[model samples]
Target: MHSSAVFLIEFGAIILGLGLLGRMAGRLKFSPIPLYLLAGLAFGEGGLLPLGASEEFVAIGAEIGVILLLLMLGLEYTATDLVTNLKTQYPAGLVDGALNALPGAAMALLLGWGPVAAVVLAGVTWISSSGVIAKVLGDLGRLGNRETPVVLSILVLEDLAMAVYLPIVTALLAGAGLAAGSVTLAIALGVAGLVLFVAVRYGRLISRFVSSDDPEKLLLVVLGLTLLVAGIAQQLQVSAAVGAFLVGIALSGEVAEGAHNLLSPLRDLFAAVFFVFFGLHTDPTSIPPVLLPALALAVVTAGTKIATGYWAARRNGISAKGSWRAGGTLVARGEFSIVIAGLAVSAGIEPSLGPLATAYVLILVVIGPLTARYTEPVASWVIARRRPSGPASAPEPQAAAEESGGAHDELADTVRHDR
Candidate 1:
């Protein structure tokens, strides 16, 4: 009875706190993620007012949070969209991986952490926070922007890569041999392929099976199915999040839309808990030791992410401004970074990795929204300032206008051709 009461009180207070934080963020016109992280820090180890009883439940909620995040993300598009993205935007994905992943790997090696840590850190830096990006896009009303699909395509490629990468990392951290790792990789790939095939070919059947006119039944069925699949995937040494994503992909049409509406609130609640859970495990004091490096890494990677977005957008024939927006939108790295760092920390891979990852994510997540809002205007201002003065600059405006007109005409032609 005592334990139950304690759990109730602690968890209740957490939910209440999150609600207030979210309201405040709404009023302030910014994301509540950083505030959520700060709250976690305060309640976590080495911080003020730590809790004892509710931590385990919070941990489970955090796992559910990740699963729901990936699942909902998967529901946003079809398997056909994924395959199309993989085929068309692969070059951009390659650029993204090389430009962003290299810095973290290089940093790890330079710090004497060896190859494994390098690989882990590379992953941490490589993928942007899909949750954060999605929220920002909705909040900024950029979901329908020309560059938005470009952004989503790049993110999809990264998520698909994670389906493969996580299994390999799991095998490596467990000290598996080369053959074992290869086998694990093969299994992950096979499962992913099967899921994709089913989603593409038999999605209508799966959706019909799961769909219901009753919201209550739909919610129960989808939630139960997702948790079951996620658990089984984990048991099979595949990523639970990947399983959840595949489940989402297998449901389409009205079923997908209905599930999204029913599950969105749940997704938000658990996602907040997940962010707090990340903060809970991190010691506040450890961050200072790595703060400088984390800051430096955040700054460098932010630029690379911007470059990745810009290149991808331009490849898709988006305007310069849209390309800049795409780049800025990809700057924030949240849940996955923490997940990767958490794995390494649990495996005792590197002592400072956790603190560094925490600090790095904090810096970027905070800056992400600001950059998304201002990157284009700022870039325009900088370019204008650098232009040569006098007669050269005077006719340049007319020439630039003509160039822009030509570009728009070409874009219109391309759009019509695509149609």
Candidate 2:
């Protein structure tokens, strides 16, 4: 009885604290992800304080958080869309992997963490946070931009790649031999292919069956289906996230939209808890020794991500402006980076990997939004500086006179509009 009360107190305090942190992040106009992780650090093993009874509950919530994150991601697209992305976006995905993923792998090798850790770190850097990127796009009014599709295509392919990547990582972490790993990959790919085939052929049927007039029933059915599929996939040594994602792709039309609407809040809550949970396992004291490497890796990966986005957009015929915008937009990595790192941490691959990942993610997540806002503008400014000042540029006096007149007219128009 005493323990139960203590558990409630700890858990309740955590939720309330998270709410406050999230609210603060909103007002500050940044992702609450870093804040949540920081909060977790504050309450974890070697931080300001530690919880006794509520840790178990938090661990479970973290797992569910991951499932919902993937499910919602899957809900964003149909199997048809996946097929389309695969057909057209393979080159971009390859470039993205080579440019962005290699830095982390190189860094891991440099740190002497061995090949398994290299694979793990490579994944940590390869994928961008779809959640964070989507939110940033919406906030900045880039969702309707021409380059937005280019950005999104890259993300969709990454999502697909993760389906294969996670299972491989799982196999490696489990100490499976090359033979065992091959079998795991084979199972994962086969499962993924089957899910896609089913989704493409019977998606409507699946969604219709899950659809309901009652909101409560709809929520229960969708959530239950996702969990069941996720658990089964985990049992089969396929990634639970991959399973949840396939479920999302399998449900289309009204069912997908309704489930997204209903499950969004749940996704947010659990997702926040998931970030917090990652932080809990990281010792705050371990971060400093890794601070330099994390920063260096963050810088390199940020550049590579921008390059990947820029090249992808350009290859698809996007203009310099839009391509730069896409590049900058992809710089922020959030949820998925942590998700990959969390796996490594749980597998006990390397002690420093968690702290390094924590620091790396925190740095990038904070800088992502800012870079999205400024990268294009900064690029244009540099281009302007490099151009020779010919007769067209030498007309400052005339240009200023014309500009002043235009400003006067614009000010008059603004006054009339305001009136």
Candidate 3:
């Protein structure tokens, strides 16, 4: 009874605190993620106040948060959208992987954390936060922009890549041998293929089966199904997040829209909890030691992400202004970075990885919005400053020659008329 009372008090306080923090962020016109992380730090191991009883409950909520995040992300598009993005935007995806992922891998190796840590860090740096990007797009009223499709295509491809990447990382973290890892990879691919096939061919059927007029029933059914699939996928050594995402992809039409609306509140709640949980496990003191490296990585990756968006948009023949907007929009890395690092930390791969990732994400998430808003104008300003003050000599000479020739021709025509 005493423990139950403690849990209630602690959990209640945490939720209330999160709510307040979220409201503060909303008023400040920024993401509440960093604030949530700070709160977790304060309540975590080395911070001002540590909670004893509600930690386990918070942990469970955090897992659910990740699941819901991937699931809702999946619902944002149909199977056709995914396939189209994979085919059309693959080059951008590859560029994104190479440009952004390499720095994290290099940093890990330099830190002597081994190849496994390098791979883990690569994922942490590779993915941009779709949730954050989408929110920013809406907030900035850029959803209707020409470059928006290019941005969405790139995000879709990244999410698809995650479906494949997560399984490989899972196998690696479990210390599986080559054969075991290959088997796990094959299974994951097979499951993903099967889900895609089903979603593409019979998504409406699946949705009809799950659909209901009652919101409560719909919510319970969707949530329960997602959890069941996620648990089974985890049991099979696949990513639970992937499983939830696949479940989401298998529903379409009104069912997908309805489920999305019903689950959004839950997703937000659990996602906040997940961020806090990540911070809870990280010691505040550890962040400072790794702050410099984190800052460096954030700066490097932010530029790469901008390049990625610009290249993708330019390839699509968007205007330079649109392309710049596209690049800036993709600069922020948020939830997925934390998710990847959280996996590594939970597996105990590297002790310092968590703190470094936390600090890196904090820097980027805050900088992301600012860059998205200013990258284009800032680039334009710099270019304008570097440009020559006057017209080029070549153009000036050509203009003068044309003017003189026109004058001579007019005089000749006048003389000919007089004669």
Error of 2 at 367 (Å): 0.4
Per-residue lDDT of model 1, residues 195-307, tens digit only: 89999999999999999999999999999999999999888777788789888878888998899889989988998998888888888998898999999999999999999
Best by lDDT: 2
Off by over 4 Å in 1: 390-419
Give the TM-score ranking, best first: 2, 3, 1
Query: Model 2: runs farther than 4 Å from truth?
Result: 391-419
**Every model's TM-score:** 0.91, 0.93, 0.92
Give the lDDT of residue 163 in candidate 1: 84
lDDT of 1 at 64: 92
Residue 229 miss distance in model 3 (angstroms): 0.4
- Residue by residue across 342-370, what tens digits does model 2's lDDT show? 98999998999999999999999999998
TM-score of model number 3: 0.92
Model 3 lowest lDDT segment of ten: 410-419
